[model samples]
Target chain A: MSLTADDVNKIAYLARLGIDTQDTESYAKDLSGMLDLVAQMSNINTDDVAPMAHPLDQVQRLRTDAVSETNNREAFQKIAPQVEAGLYLVPKVIE
Target chain B: MHTKTIAQLAKGLRAGDYSSQELTASYLARIKQHTELNSFITVTEEQALTVAKQADMALATGNAPLLTGIPIAHKDIFCTQGVKTSCGSKMLDNFIAPYNATVVEKLDTAGTVSLGKLNMDEFAMGSSNETSFYGAVHNPWASNTVPGGSSGGSAAAVAARLIPGATGTDTGGSIRQPAALCGITGLKPTYGRVSRFGMIAYASSLDQGGPMTQTAEDAALMLQAMAGFDAQDSTSVEREVPDYSAGLNNSLQGLKIGLPKEFFDDGLNNDMASCIETAINEYKKMGAEIIEVSMPNLKLAIPAYYVIAPAECSANLSRMDGVRFGHRCTDPVDLNDLYIRSRGEGFGTEVKRRILVGTYALSEGYYDAYYIKAQKIRRLISDDFKRALQEVDVIMGPVSPSPAFGIGEKTSDPIEMYLADIYTIAINLAGLPAMSIPAGFIDNKPIGLQIIGNYFAEDKLLNVAHQYQQVTDWHQQTPQGFA
Candidate 1:
């Protein structure tokens, strides 16, 4: 149930988060500790129980496909780190 | 003027005893004077004064709302139009919300003056306010002690009389834990009771907005304004919003209070047990019959919660990538580099730890073992509450394991910090309405008596807390220097 340095790196990569190389061992220890805590759930047999996603057991209420929001592109993009012509700019992926 | 409750302030404003402008000024001055508490992240003084003047004009017409001109602040988690809504994270430190959260808008509609945004744990993650990027909020009772948090600023500010009341959100024990630590009243309404539109999401299923105030009466007033259905938030409940203050004076005669035996075991502090017991004794005198109930699944709450909350947080926080808004890295070689470095630089240690854990838990080959397993345990914990509440009107217990710990006491150990929420976390898992009221103090630190009720039982919980407040003066007791 314990995580290793390799597991920590794999998790960081999957999460798309950068972790300092020197901190991997410590992160491994912390993550493993959490796994140990979470491991306690094994004591109970929940094979017959249905997984509850919502607290009230209510399903998502769907609505008609009508447009309910107005375009506020200018206002919305005002806080972006980089934007031009109503487009959010990120690193070039296709290139 | 600063010591007056929201009810008293509202009455005075209407009766011409003091203008809303004067009250706003007084609270603004107090907030400025207590800079050491680090309770507020932003103070909207100019906006508050302008709004107070307008409130004064509305009051003159004799038809203003009950909360008219009352100065209050919001937890930084709520998006406030044109105001910085940090959620106490460096990622959003520079972000100004384009629109108001439904809670903020509703409060404004009720004519409550906005004092500004209070600090919180970064993205509402930690139990202690120390996780906040702005800095740890000092407990009003003891400056060296930690103010219980993610809603630490709201609790501390209200306790220090910086603001009469403020909004707080509880994902885990954010609202009630801090309220108990700071010796104030805080309520976490049932899931979806209050609209979550524009409220920065942490754990969507578990997070709920409520009032952190000096008394249950004030919390009722705040909840009356904050609770309702919103088209903007799909999860918003469509139930009727009852007059929360209407049942404040209701008799507790024949009220059945269920006490979970597990909460009173050796884990509870001796002083906290006595204080909570004394509070229950007062309820007994008022004709409440206490029944000891056993909820075996309660111990699994923390483990399950850690999994579910972090899993949700990881998905929700993924939107904080470098492109659209929030922090972006100075330079990036590629898209992956942009996301990885931006998130790594923006988020704090605890937040990163959670995201990684969530990533691992939901990854291939482990989703059922960790995520689904936690969900099943969540149902078991919730069912335990259902069984207990079926037999009693409400459940009463300690709000926190103990009073406020020293600022650095448990910071080195995350597990210890998580365990501190043991008494309060189960209620959130069940999505039940619950409250923490000032029961008494131990070693000058506050202890809160938690009153948990069935779903959408906000009125009942408020009534129970209000009746208790009527007989006790603990909620009235302010920290010495602040008073």
Candidate 2:
């Protein structure tokens, strides 16, 4: 149930929360505490039970394939972090 | 004027006792007075007065709806157009919602004036309201005690008479826990009962919005306008919205009540247990039969909830990638740094911890071991509720283990804070309707008697709460200073 420093780094990387050497120890302790909490469930055998994905057995609802909403790109992009020329500007990925 | 319930206010508004503008002013003044409570994030005074003037005009023409001109403080979780819907997190601190959430739009259409945004836990994560980036909301009953949260601000404001009624979203007892501690009435309708179109996502499977008010009748009136089907929300149930106000006077004769044995174990506070026992006896005297029920799987609810909620939240919050909308770190060398720092800087400790845990649970190798195991136990918990519900009309229990605790009491330990919701989370897993009504007080703080019912049984739940409220005066008792 204990998470190692390496394990903590992997989790931090997966979750996309910046973690350095100092914070990793505390993160390890906190996460290990939680992992121990969930580890108890593993003891009770759930061999035949189906995993409950949702409270209700709902189908994936579909609507007619047609454009319903008017274009509000200008309104939506106004809140973006960095947008220019009607496009979101993210960090350089390819270049 | 501030102490009047929504029902009374609606009546007075129609009778021309006062205009919506006058009532709106009173609430605004009190919001200014109770700055120490930290209950509100933004008081939209100018917008409220403008809406109130329109409501007054509507009421004068004798063409007003049920809740026309009543003032309501909305939870900051909902997206109110042109207002800051922070959800008590720095991630969305700069987020000024461009469009109104469905709850906001529906309430506005009914002519209820918006008093502004109420505070909440950071992304509805904390049991105590202390997780808010805006600062923790103080319990109205005691200045130093924490108001039971996620909906802490909504409950505190209503108890302090800052607003007669307010809207709160309960992911895992957010609405009910605060309502209990603050000596107010709150309802969390069956999952999918209310539209979640624009309500900020916490755990998509468990989130449901309902009313937090002084009386069950007021809750009914507010809920009538709030519940409905929407094309926007994928999980919104397509059903007829009953007249919740009409069922308030239904007789409680021969009502069957089940008290879950698991809820009253050795961990329960003695004082809170006594108060709940007294409330149950009151129900028995009102011609309701009480029976002992067993929900063996209820013990696993907290663990299962923590796992399921965090996992869902991890997926849901992935939308906040700094590029779209929210706080972005300065001078990012690459997208990875942008994602990491923006989220790291934006979220608080508890939020980050949950995100990390969720990512671990949902990651490649551990998915089957943790996430699937919790989901399986979730089925057992749901089955337990389904079985117990068949034997009884409703299940009764404590909304929380004890009344409101000191603000910093459980802040250092997340597990202790999570255990506070041990009595309440299973209902969300079962997707049933439940409520916390003011039962009594423990050491000057309030305790709520929780009534849980089967799916789509909100009408019956509200009826029972209203009947109990009729016989007891607990819901009528306001905090000393506030009164």
Candidate 3:
């Protein structure tokens, strides 16, 4: 798939990256090259092959349904960009 | 003291040759001398020394274990209880881990001193250390060239003698490739051999933490401490992990080594080929037999990895939304704005590109065409390894197509960067154990011989690497000017 200018723009928007119009051509070119390289898989004859998701075929073992973390709220919130009243603060949505 | 292996250091500490405080200070001093390499993201001198002092006290009381007081560096991806685990991205620049990863707990119980967090590619995405948010790690071999990433810092530190050993995680080729570039020994054990409870996810299925050191024996010593089943990591295997260092001198006589035909194709550099050939010949002299093996699906590994890794990364990173921990945006009009702006400002170019590609591949109409297809191809790659391993005890190949490339050589072209990982990605895709042993030098730059083995065959891989190292001085040779 060749990426159109509009497609590149949409992808950038969805990815939350700010790409100016001038950079679109190069971005499209690069993304196209990467896509072209990745497109090689389409030619392989994997018709009878079952998809392998995990390296091992074993089922995932379950851990006890218990909280492994403690109440380190004060320490945890220290890295937040913006916080108030021990809660992470964001812009008002319903206003 | 600076050049001693981890085992040697541990033995010396045990024999009262030096106190833990003295050993830790020597490493700290070496780290201070090699700041230009940019191997470390942070140096926990105060914490390390305090721990070392306690270790010294324990030694006096005759209560010290093998790892007690040995200073080691951790890749920035492993979460520490209070240390900032950045994963080389500004996205988590201020984020401190609330709990210790299981590996961290194990090491702490062994009494290993925490040197600090090492630098890496952002979210373990890049093949070169240039993508790190902190700075690029210089290959100790050639200052202008890149150390392979995203575990470049760990490899660099060990190569430069700044640290005897360090921990690194491999998703695609992070550990092995960097180890190759830096002329050190690095191992990526079978998928579930080591617990991943505290490791920040890249591609969950492919990620496994291993050791980087100057020799395979040092890697073994470190791996002995790092491996084991952990109830915290659901994927952690419940098998018994043998003492990896116990068989370092094991006979390589009659051991069958497979040279994958695909790995030596046109893309491989002549110098790298010659270096690997020399290493193989050295192994032949040591009584190991070499056989040519074929893995036709090897070519598809890169493409399959690109799809699966990004698809998983997209899902894993979604939890980094501004509403949770990590970097968040300033005042926002709503939660959506908060997430969008925070992510926009947080992630680097390569990371954002991956997230976009991953999201698109998994999107409504493209899921089967991309993600599902990649999964099917992934199986074929694993089967290829299985068939080859049945014929040979271990496989040997070039860790990378060439030695370390110049910084900015392939950064502009992401495809080139992806291709740089061609030789190493298949082992990760297959989820088997592999290691990069310092084979020889190509034009003053180091080349690595990749030793791959069957699942849970870490001991065998280390044995082969250790046997080869015993017969060759490549692991002992140091880069000029630095030495």
lDDT of 2 by residue, B208-326 (tens): 99999999999999999999998899999889999887888988889999999988999998999999999999999989999899999898988888899999899888888899899
lDDT of 1 by residue, B1-483 (tens): 888899999999988999999999999999999999999999999999999999999999999999999999999999999999999999999899999999999999999999999999999999889999999999999999988999999999999999999999998889999999999999999999999999999988999999999999999999999999998888888889999999899999999999999999999978889999999999999999999988999999999998998899999999999788889999798999999999989999899999998888899999999999999999999999999999999999998988999998898889888888898888888899999999998999998999999999999999999999999999999998899
What C-alpha lDDT do the candidate models reach, one value each?
0.93, 0.91, 0.88
Select the stronger candidate by DockQ from 1 and 2: 1
**TM-score of structure candidate 3:** 0.97
Displacement of the residue B374 alpha carbon in candidate 2, Å? 1.4
Q: State what share of the real interface contacts each candidate retains.
A: 0.80, 0.80, 0.65
- Complex DockQ, candidate 3: 0.61
Clashes of 1: 0
Worst 10 residues of 2 chain A by lDDT: A35-44
RMSD in Å for all candidates? 0.8, 1.0, 1.7
How far off is residue B8 in model 1, in Å?
A: 0.6
Docking quality tier of model 2: high
> Which residue pairs in model 1 clash with each other?
none
Q: Candidate 2: where is the Cα deviation over 4 Å? A: none
**Candidate 1, residues A1-95: lDDT per residue as tens digits?**
88889989999998899899999999998888888888899999999999988899887878899999998888789999999888999888995
lDDT of 2 by residue, A1-95 (tens): 89998998888888888776788888888888887777778778899999987778777689999999989898889888989999999899997
